[model samples]
Target: MNAKELHDKTPDQLREELASLKKESFNLRFQQATGQLENAAKIRAARRNAARVKTVLNQKAAAAATDAE
Candidate 1:
């Protein structure tokens, strides 16, 4: 997923997506530790996706705070 797609989602939705991405990242790590991981690229993709979600969430929070002020 990209920032543009995440930007359209509400904070709650973005939070949910972030949760799922984190779960996937954990699973990928576990597979790697067990030497069962077939594709290492997934780990990088998951990390980047999680970061993108976080960035969007932070941006939303900052915007809300600014509006409140």
Candidate 2:
């Protein structure tokens, strides 16, 4: 939902959540097309959450890479 929550999750949990968010985004789009979605802001929120997940994953990967060097 937010960076604080995202950052607090363990790496494995973050990965799981990322996958779930992506799936939800896809469903949201489907609902939008079918005229079931009410709030447009939800799509934006989902997208932002997806990005937050990605940023955290990248940070972890980069940290690991730096440690190897």
The best candidate by lDDT is 1
Off by over 4 Å in 1: none
- Candidate 1 collision pairs: none
RMSD (CA, Å), candidate 2 to true, equals: 1.0
Candidate 1 weakest ten by summed lDDT? 1-10
- Return the top candidate by TM-score: 1
Q: Each prediction's Cα lDDT score?
A: 0.97, 0.90
Prediction 2 TM-score vs. true: 0.90
- Over the stretch 1-69, how does candidate 2's per-residue lDDT look in tens digits? 678888788889999998999999999999999999999788889999999999998898898899999
Error of 1 at 24 (Å): 0.1
